[model samples]
Target: MAKKADKYFKEDKWKIIEEGFNPDYGMVSESIFSLANEYMGVRGYFEEGYSGNKLIGSYFNGIYERSEPDYNHYKGVADFTEYMVNSVDWLYTRIEIDNEQLDLYKSDFEKFYRELDMKTGILTREFVWKTAKGKRIAIKFERCLSMTEVERSTWQASIKALNFNGKIYVTTGLDFSNIHRNSGENMWNCGEKFIQADKNITLGIEGTTINTGLKVSSNCKIQADYESMEEIIEDKLVAVKLCINLEKNKEQKITKIIRNLTLKDESQKEEYEDKKAKIKDGRDDVIVLNEELKEESRKWWENVWKRSDITIDNDIENQQGIRFCIFQMYQTYNGAVKGTNIGAKGLTGEAYNGNAFWDTETYCLPFYLFNDREGAKNLLYFRYKTLDEARKRAEVLDCEGAFYPIATISGKECCNLWQHASLQLQASTAVAYGIWFYEKMYNDKAFIKNYGLEMLIEISRMLATRGDFDKDGKYGYYCVMGPDEFQMMVHNNCYTNYMGRFTLKYTIEKVKEMKEKYPKEYEKVVKKINFKESEMNKWKQIIKNMIIPYSDDTLIFEQHDGFFKLPHVDIDSIPISDFPLYNHWSYDRIYRNDMIKQPDVLMFMLLFNSDFTKEQLKANYEFYEPRCIHESSLSPSVHSILANQLGKEEEAYDFFGFATRMDLDNYNRNTNEGIHTTSIAAAWMNIVYGFGGLRSDGEILSLSPTIPKNWDGYSFKLTYNDEILEVKVNKEEVTIKTLGNKLIEIKVFDKVELINDEGYTYKFT
Candidate 1:
């Protein structure tokens, strides 16, 4: 309920809002953030100017992996761990007002604020400035949403002068080197720009990459110039115009235009102009595709509302928060490749250098599986697409089976052994867990056998080969660094042990099915791996009885064996200033403390949702919530969701809000770098799986709704078993609806199952 009085992002549902005078900086993000799903997406970003901490990452579904110089020791082993740096960011141009850089932070400014309105979809930024001559001015900016180009996007900004007015200068140009080292790993090479531009107004700005000419699939032209009393127009590949007007004691308005062009058409300038004319005249053009894009966005969400449960009620602000969370998550999924999973920031922020991690398997995919099962299925396909690379990764390591990349923009294992570079085993299970989630969400024998089963088998193969068994009759999977980064060189991690159990079960089952059904695939894989029948026996033995450390003394799960030998410190005693102590505290300090950057056992419990008993889930949630430092951007939301499910309402609210408001409130004080996309997606999952309680376990779609007190009511849709259903939930009751044709059943509160509902209402969990 405190969230109601809090001055922060107060939306509980996702709505497309329309607005004007949206500042370019926020608009670029809003537009980029105003992403959609139809197999691809990119947050619309400004191609020019002083946008703070902007990393405009545009990614294609399943189109990653740089095979050139293998980052992993493996040579041309079909690495799926590489996330290639692909396009040009036209949104970053330096701003020098009167030759004095108008660095907003360093100015004698009175008023400054920014807003990203998802309702109607617009971005706005406002600021008051006292010029060098002591003249006061106000600036308001806005940008438009582009459903026009699915991959390409557009943005615009308006500047104004209020009170004392004076002539001001604004500069717009593209910033090319926004790429930073992800996870502070390898030094990434800033690819060259073949296209060059030099203050040529008539032609706008244009250039080609020096080396990466065709690497990028799309080309875009974005331009902005200060508006005077009239409109200034420039024509070349795209139309760009700046409109500025001065009001008496008010402000000035400036707008930027971004035009997306097709890379397939490498036509001459005249050809592009002719195409533009035809488009204007209603010829074969992108405008039609644009229309479909809008339908896709609407239809996508509409279909989503069909089966997903909604738990928050009337408090529109909280309602907006929930929808916005889910909407953002939907925007992040690209579905074509396994390596092409959502980022830490989920396309919302450029921070974390926009790399994929355990977050995808551990947090994201489950939400997608129940609500958007097709998308979830595609996530598995992504892993399968990279299976060759996984195997090649093994070859490079002189091992059998696949070893997926820890962090990558492309599918290759680009992560060096540093931060989580050491948690390579977690990355391996990411694919393995994804396979498990798929099976849990959809027990479709055809889907599993025809598609998922193979990928599962391959990934399971990776674990079987990668995991070393101990001598004791009780089997243990080894050589894995657990979630506790401080406690390195670990063995018998409970999480890894569980993953091996899951892998072995699925791998053995899938492999056996293939051997019976698709003998050729079974024979080929067997020949390729030189796998013996005894291997299946080994997997069965290990899976049936893997040793997991239990602490009857504490009634909590140990991170792994020998974890009790480590010291314990109260996480709450730590000060906020020492946030991100992972870098400040000695590894020993962390190892000795009862703090964690993210979930270890809890992660396993959530990902393998049905595996743990409710009491176990509750116990883990209570014990870990207190000690969790949430230093990792991906932490709070997960705990929030779990807490909500366990009736830890207050804890759930805090964590959920923390996840939602992280960047907006600067909760972690790290927003200056960029928003945490991975955490943002986790925040959404915390809502869907935690509060909305939507989980599909191979057959039954289940719901356990619990709205935070601050939220009035929330509603969402899900596409389950080809049926479209919508669920609305509030403090008191929940509603369900079927938007698509199909007779299907869904478990409400993990108890009642609803069948073929045109719409149905039931008591809330």
Candidate 2:
């Protein structure tokens, strides 16, 4: 059966709270409370240890290990795959009172409470332990990844003896024995360890076997009011044991400040050598103290709230949901580091092998574009850096130019399934869209000329060569899959063809503009790529002849050629146990039916909403909404946005919660795998694009806001055209006010209005 939201968490405007611990929902809670700061993420597993179901995930972005591939004679199949490997357990802790180690699964506990503070980026958990000898001890654990520092994490534990005076022992340090859950393999080889007992500090370094040049160094400093301390070093483990004398009703706090630095042999050799020399020379390992790190992260989160917070007045459930979404979005990625993109699970879990998909551009980019433009540029820049790998992938598939991978960790195609790895075209087109979209929002023409235009030209080349004309002389992609995974190897998938046309047309337009406005720089880029006039002519020709399936009578586009001829299955009739059909049903059985894994035609409609009329959107929404099973985490929010656009308010709200609480409620029964990072972005899209009526596809920023029935009002912020605008929607009217000093032009219900410091208001009819 599909999992329902466990609802174990208490609702609050700025926190996710759990009053009593439920072992049945342990993994789900771990995922919901996971903490990350772009640089690293750690699942909310027990620091004192849990014997029950749990994934001890602590991941660093861009650090990955490659696995041997199953050899296949097929040409387009991937020969090997690389995945993000599980790294150091920075929160590893062991608490011992009278030699009885604290284990939540085995120990007696009361008043178990945990909360993830959205406003401050801290996760706190506390419980009272009843020892075997009838002594009670209260313990609290708090952790936060520094938002400002990026590479540092602070873990603090407070303990008090409630009944009797006793000695409590705490062992904590960075542990490097983590295993990749999917492969059941420990990929790291412990390299070096240093301990300084007098200073209460330890450092360790480990390197992956396959990707040996990738090394991670963890330096930890222990601070506590303890009676004694000792350094303990073991195989693949480095820790310090602290003995603290506790008096009745007196609390003692121990803090572990950790800083992790990752280095690649290819890019960071000098920096790595310098750090190694410093460690060897016995220099102090620098780290931000706990309170200082906490303060810095507090200011960082405050700024994030000032710029990105969405306020929902009447519904605390959704209010908490949306904040949680925004908080996770920031935690997953803040663009602090270059050469990194949002993973499918965003360092939350091991699922998707810690690889990024097309969702980085298609779904996650808008969130960052509106909140952090620099970060958005980094996302696109990662693609540009990986362009050579993309070109190699296209050559492997017997095509020209760049073909961005379906999944990647270090910019190489890693998905093993040939069907998805080779046939899907959205990944390439999504990169082009990201470039176009980024330029549209920020008006950074230099970024396009310097970095984006080259990628766009190569992507246009890939799409042009990858597709061909049918016997009827109509250009379309054959044997391909669109956004909907359920229908594969189909010809003329409307979404794919339309996006291809968009990519080609956009690339052509940019090339012409560059030639006219910046002829000198344009000539340099053109010469670098060996520019040919014929290729541009061919792209224009393909754009003109691209076939997008549509029906004039119904005003509804067929999802793909022969899609209507496929036998239909009643999605509602499917048993709950059969959900996530990939697991329960035969693989071939899924593709034979008309059930959609996600939006295909509706996806393009949303991406290019400005190009379609209301009647066309309504017609397609009515026709396609029923067939979607929404197996993908990115599905529901797209439906929600379109439903709101069509005035189906009730249906829109129905799908809204699913995107916001997909992990919190554990609706898909897969939260154990990881947080749905893309769906988290979609939740933001639901509020801003769905209910707030914001559309960026057109020239002028537009809005046609509608308040949900349960909401008293809602407000959100958007960063556009180098200005921040606060948009508020209530029952009576919609308000748009610039947070900056500049006047902004926006379309409200098809009427143009100028908004400034005083704001512009449009009353509902």
Top lDDT hit: 2
List, residue by residue over 388-462, the lDDT tens digit for candidate 1.
766766667655667776665545566655435534577777776777666655656665655565566556666
Give the C-alpha miss distance for residue 675 in model 2, angstroms: 0.5
| CA RMSD per model (angstroms) | 6.8, 1.6
Off by over 4 Å in 2: 1-3, 209-212, 276-287
lDDT of 2 by residue, 357-391 (tens): 99899999999999998899999999998999999
lDDT value for model 1: 0.56
Taken over the whole model, the C-alpha lDDT of each candidate is 0.56, 0.88
TM-score of each: 0.75, 0.98
